[model samples]
Target: MFYSSSWSKCLICLIFITSGNAECPKPQVEGNFVLTNDALLKNDFPEGTEATFECANGYLKEQGSERITCTSGEWSTLELTCKKKDCGAPRKIAHLTYEFGEEGTLFGASAKAICDKGYQLMGSSYRQCYANGWSGRPRCEVVTCEKPIEIKNGTITEQPDKEFPEYGGVIQYSCDEGYTLIGNKSIECNEDGEYNSVPPECKDGNDIPLKPTTTISTTSITTTTTSTVPPIIRDVDDIPLKPTTTISTTSITTTTTSTVPPIIRVSGRNNGIGEHDTNAATGNAAVVGSVIGTVIVTLIVLFTLYRFYKRKGSYQTGEDPSRKEELLQFKNN
Candidate 1:
């Protein structure tokens, strides 16, 4: 029993010596480490030690080496990664939207902003997408076409004021009689969201001419008469039964009748029972008619005589009885 006890004591001593000799020394912890971002450097750790990494709030570790066992008092070559706050690329816009500020940004990216129609985006238009949630609170602003409100003589030619991204455009208008325009006559789009000038005025009016004018009147009179005159004699047998002579004469007279208006002046007598008064209207008409008739009668008589002489051969051949028969028939017809 005493011997067994001594052996046990010896074994205990041997165990303690072996344990002391085999123990791994505390890792040297020599390699420099970066606490910032938990990013590991090229020489971050040594082969014989262990290492741990951590990231700041709003940050995360991309690669972790929280604990590494030491081999030969050195850690295996390793790396730790701390990710900077990652703002995801701007989200896919739900509706078609324009960018007024920087785009394609990172977690801390910021930019001026605006909404589509009707509403506007407020807050420091510029904002960041962060791990701490979207940076600036975005509020919807009301869009309006206020001030100088009415277009005056003109109407809105295009869409009125509306919420839009920075640099969004606008249009205005005016109207006038007898005139028109096709395209937008005036337009403005600025970073400030206000129009630059008012719409233009249309051209003025012009006059045209009228139709023509004139006046006048006229009158005429006609009369007919009958007369007796002989045809030319072609033969002796054509002897006439009566004188082939016409007598005509004319006279003038003025008369005033009670029926005549006082506005017209009248003169002479209207009595019809006396010898033609040199001043009687009837006597005058008769005298003139007689004169004309006498002239015509004289011409007829002369013509007949010449024809008679020609048929009778009174000048050159003395006379021809058969020819006279022919002349007589001619005169009768």
Candidate 2:
């Protein structure tokens, strides 16, 4: 019994010795930070052991202590505040403007480069903000125009210095004696790097081409139509005919009579007026009829527009309000 008690006491002592405060897992917290040299080297963090941190790249400390302690096998909440570092405003470039994006001048920000008028960008237009400074060096180059093409039988008497031509530069041309200039004598280099007008041409005064005298002739065709000059018959029997119309809204019907001019057929001999002459007369009559129809339609439209304006004016004008009341009363009745 005494030996049994001694064994039980020894077991109790062993268990107590084995169970001293357990070492905490590696300490960690939520934020953009890195552990100190001591904390990173050691894998084990006993309870009450403290660890230190520093802000990561591109970030600077804002507030709060960088140190934290492990309590009861757990890391304390992160109290360190780290904010993005500033790269400062970019340097001013000649003829260059910038468009800073959100979070301006801070890390990871960007600026779009814009060149002024008569200039163009030469490098990457986008510059990014970094932990050290901006990413690339962008520049603006002035716009220029190429030399004008040579004109035939003409000479470019006046132009900008042979080196290069910029915006608003003009090139003047002249023709040789006995030759005349065709188009504008001068071409200008506008804001965009291009000639504003086509170059002029030089043409000899005696070298002009003319059209043929009988160029109005129709193509080769043999006609058998024998009718000679379709007679212009104007009488009461051939009065202008119209179709019938009926209005359902007013229960009104209008009936009209149509009279077709007689078709006079002649022998199938080649008369002075054959198919060509007959067709030409018909075409003339059609053109006259189209002109008359257009005039009549225009008059009708003008009358309709006038009547609409008169009706609208009657409503808008302050004349005879009592008359409108009387009309309303008549309707009700």
Candidate 3:
């Protein structure tokens, strides 16, 4: 009985040791290796539990555990991790500028983007590291606005000299003459670089009046007169009646005549006697007579004045109001 009891105690001790050893399973030597958070580590399994390692879409198997088993209740190692997809981070750009990561970190499953100086970011700043082993490549672009110069009737006179840095560029407007500009004089570049208002218009000017016309008419009329004459008369003593000899076949004769005088005027004449005269046959005799008479009268007056001067020179010596002569002087002896 004593021997049997000692044997039973030893068996109980062995069973206890076995249970403890199984529970604490030695660090896995051959089960499998696992990658965790970009690192590889051996894991000890727990009682009644099993584990398996798998990479996400953007990850790959490098040197990590794919699966582990619990034979006596001990695990192999911690869950294995998958290396990040080999693809690089999405390209980053700002204001048309770009930059790249110094050391591409794909294991962390994070993607980064950046732009160069003087440029600004346009789209999403971040990206995802995909299971395919790469981050979504982002696009970088430039930003710009619209230009000014909205033309209505006519076109813009000219374009800007230089490219506008801002959104809206500037332009000036003009129109053909006889037409007036109705809208804004100058155009501005909007933030989007578009014109603000519609183009100007061309209008007409004022009007003037005209002159008038007229017409005229003329007419004429005629009249006639008739008369009968009595038989010819004779002196009382010698009065002779119609001759008896010619009474059988008497005949008589009659004649008529008409005359027109030339026209004349009396203007610009020195005297009342002018170009009017009865001498119709002499066309210019009266005019010539008038001119000759005037010349002769002038010569007579000049000769009389000369004679009066000679007489005065021969006799005159003293000054008298009536005589009206300044006599020549003689030297005294």
Candidate 4:
């Protein structure tokens, strides 16, 4: 019984000493960190024990080992350190601006992108910081409009370049000579790829009056004067029943008269009437008078020849011998 009691006491003392020596010193970190794969959250560790350290959110490990060990009742020397994650300054984007959502450019931080006036964004408007770098890189581009349609009888006078017009660009319009404009003289490109107003059109000028035509005609006439025969008087009883007229012995003379009338013609631009001149009337009268005189002389000669022939025939028959002889003697004389 005494031997068993001594052996039990020795075993108890040895177990107590072993338990005291096995306990490890607590480890101190320079910055915010946590043990890797540790579920208990214990501050101490046993001899020959190992652990890995991880930095807190928004922090990164710097110039240190992430692994440590406990040995001989003490913790091994740890050079572990942590610092705030640093994403460099934001990159410059043409025609774009940015705003930070947080004070530092650390993990989980973000920035918002904004396009300048007359500009547009080609990518995401928000950027986020990560362990490697920024989450996205956005770009800015100038807003543009479609090509303007051509105008009839007009031209664009103030276009500066051949490319598509940008937002807020201006185009000036003008009409050709002798044409009138029907709309605005200038138009501006808008964000919707169109102009603010419709383009102008050209119209023809006002009509002019035409001149009238007229025609006129003129005619001329000439005239001449002439003398005419005078009428003679004779006693009524002086002439017997013959067609011939007897003349008195006081320087007897024959006179002829014309009955022909003058011919007149009418002619003008409007078919107007015209009168005969005095010369034409006189010429017609002269011609008619000459013909009348010839007829009178012929009739007188015929009557004389008829009387002579009858007397000669009577004498040849000897019916009135004394009278026929007297007529023959007179004819001979």
Higher-scoring candidate on TM-score, 3 or 4: 4
Q: List the residue pairs that clash in candidate 4.
A: none
Give lDDT per model, in order: 0.47, 0.71, 0.47, 0.67
Prediction 2 TM-score vs. true: 0.52
How accurate locally is residue 33 in candidate 1, as Cα lDDT from 0 to 100? 32
For candidate 1, report its TM-score.
Answer: 0.29
Encode model 4's per-residue lDDT on 1-333: one tens digit a residue: 999999999999999888876856556656677766672377768777776788877688887887787777777766778877888768886788778875557777888899887788888998888877788879987777778767887888887485789988988988777666788998888766678898888765442222322222222222222222222332353211213334322122344434433444433323344555445466565666666665676566557656754654421222465865675667669
Cα shift from native, residue 205, model 3 (Å)? 19
lDDT of 2 by residue, 188-280 (tens): 887689888989998865454433222122222221212122223323533222323332221212222222232333222222221222234
- Per-residue alpha-carbon lDDT of candidate 3 for residues 210-244, written as tens digits (9 for 90 to 100): 12222221212122222222234443533333422
> Which candidate would rank higher by lDDT, 2 or 4?
2
TM for candidate 4 is 0.47
The estimated TM-scores of all candidates read 0.29, 0.52, 0.30, 0.47
Candidate 4 residue runs with Cα over 4 Å from true position: 1-14, 23-32, 36-44, 48-52, 61-83, 102-104, 157-163, 207-333
Ranking by TM-score: 2, 4, 3, 1
Over 4 Å off in model 2, which ranges? 1-21, 176-180, 203-333
Model 2: residue 145 alpha-carbon error in angstroms: 2.5
| Model 3: lowest-lDDT 10 consecutive positions | 214-223
